[model samples]
Target: DIVKANSREPISNEGDIYALIACCETGAERLSGMMEEFGIDHLDDLADYIIDTSYRGTIEAIAELPKGTWRNVLKVDGYEQEIDLHAALTIAEDRVALDFTGTSGLSNKGINVPLNYATAYSVFALRCIIGPDIPNNAGSLAPFHVTGPKNCILNAQPPAPVAMRHTLGQMTPDLVYGCLSQALPDRVPAEGASCMYDLPLRHTPEAVSRGDEQFALELVFSGGTGARPGLDGLSATAFPSGVWGSQVETTEAVAPVLITRRELRPDSGGPGRTRGGLGQVIEMRSSDNADFMLFLSVERVLNPANGRFGGQAAAPGRIRISRDGPDLPGKGEVRVKAGETLIFETPGGGGFGPPRERDPDDIRRDLDEGLISRQAAHDIYGLEP
Candidate 1:
């Protein structure tokens, strides 16, 4: 989301950050002049240096995420294996720095991110929590920088397993945002799912003798995110990593599966004036085949994202297979067969405003949209269904 213009000029803090970015990009001493105007000469000297490092490192990383994945390694076409990622930031002075030199080296997974993509996500995280009102651009990015080890998992070199790169890539935003939060409070949101719960499905049957036909490839859904200030946490919305939801038709047509039931988990959202977004409970099974391998990358099951302010923390996420019946323990990744169904209950977002202060109309609207159950509305928001 873009920041809206305020009625008056942006506060000096905002202007000084922008001026620093502009100077870094233009290589003009004029930015230094602007910094002097704000009593921030230290930032002027560091602006270009920060921008140069962040811009170059981010661009370079962008070029790499897709190229190193298993998809490219396997020689698959049409998937393009290409992604569009960009970076922009806002700095008030010499307060922030982006450093890629300390990041992990390249990996062999198909999910490895081009340095640029990593930069984009990192910037995005900062954007989401730092200065939602600031325009994201090269100038804003000027004061930050990132660095990684020559060949760490985050900084994959080549011939790495990149197919599941986003598994780790998506966390950069939160990681970087964590750093920013130390410098800018009130501006940052709480931590989120970080990992997309993205998984690759394949017919990697337990019995190799059965062959690959029993295996199928596909995608899955995610759980909830951490709560924000005055806003209840969001359930099931991928934050800091907004990969588009896979269309039902697209998913069915591409793989041998169908979504039997997918709906919000009642009372799943944490209580607050702005309650967390509710997570959903999804059930799925194989249509054409029963056997498949769930290659998963998920977090928050053991450690849920923490909430800021007085808001309580949201619940963790979980994935279960229902062959034996009832709540099953979710293995990070598992193999399954026909007749087996997978059930996933994502985490809930933290609450923002006080639950008692929630608008009655908003409660009614959530009930109308199936976001909050009638009971939840009454219990959490003190509104009758």
Candidate 2:
């Protein structure tokens, strides 16, 4: 019923219909306890059987879309290399499956996505696009499937690099959403921080090696979210993953560096009624002669996340060094040398409506907040400069 209502397909809930999905973590001991708490005889009687049930519902939702509608794009970052992800989206009569069979295997670095986290983000994308109206319940997830073989990056085995699961995990929605755009062109928004600031850094080696010296790490920043149907993308927010932006003072305090300038980029959002999210510029430098290491899990460099309808892609993310130095590597992990300031220009949100249709009054407010420049307000919104 939910699928039919959302996708306009004819799917009825039968008496035998039940959603049963499980993960390796759902052991007998845990299941037994849950059964007792829920007043069920066995673990199977639980409302939802698996932890990654979210992904199951998501795949099912995506499957409800017409055939060949979903396109998958895999983006891999970290460890100074790029892995082009190849993915497939398919659905069975009563169930859906998201197969990442051909993708890369677990790596020495922490790029692996735990099955649960993978399922979490995969379903998040589907919910955002396909089944927004459907309640995220066991019944809503009855029709889909998701699986990647053990030892694969999406389904890593034991002893795999699990420290940075979020790095690759966060990209799954954007990857799947990128495919969704082919079928539902206007439904998708440009990507924002598919992966949040992968600021897994150690204190300056000089300070840390000394064992007594207090050192600062790095302050990774977030930008605006992609614009929604009728709302502007939020500034300095993390979406899809629902993570919060780390406080600048907290970040600076933890590390030996100082955040010089951190502010919203004017006119960074895509122009529209529901404008794309804004971006931000973050400046950081070592207070002393300390060295800092950065685990840069970033994207939107080569392919700035493209916007829907006629909206433009948000600004590409860039890493700038002091003295107008050459562009640094955009993807993977890298180190920041001593005495050089590192600046991160984050990506902006995709536009929801045409720029010209934006309200003049709202444009004025944006200008006041330094979110959009006076020139941009005049040019994009046709307001007086």
RMSD of each: 15.5, 12.0
Candidate 2 lDDT, 1-385, residue by residue in tens: 2122123432333332542223334566686786788787854534455534654555566566666525475555544466665567654444546777777777787767788888878867866677676667766655656788888788888878787787778778777766666666557675665667545555544554575344333334676677765667887677666766656666654456677888887777777766778878887777666676665666665555555566656676777687588776664555677788888888776676677777778888888878877777877778875
TM-score of each: 0.61, 0.70
Off by over 4 Å in 1: 1-92, 98-120, 129-139, 147-163, 176-186, 205-216, 225-235, 323-331, 367-369, 373-385
Q: Give the lDDT of residue 184 in candidate 1.
A: 50
Residue 31 error, candidate 1, Å: 30
Model 2 bad stretches (over 4 Å): 1-68, 72-82, 86-95, 100-109, 112-116, 129-140, 148-163, 181-188, 208-220, 331-339, 378-385
What's the C-alpha lDDT at position 88 in model 2? 72
Cα-lDDT of candidate 1? 0.57
Candidate 2: count the clashes. Answer: 12
Task: State the TM-score for model 1.
Answer: 0.61
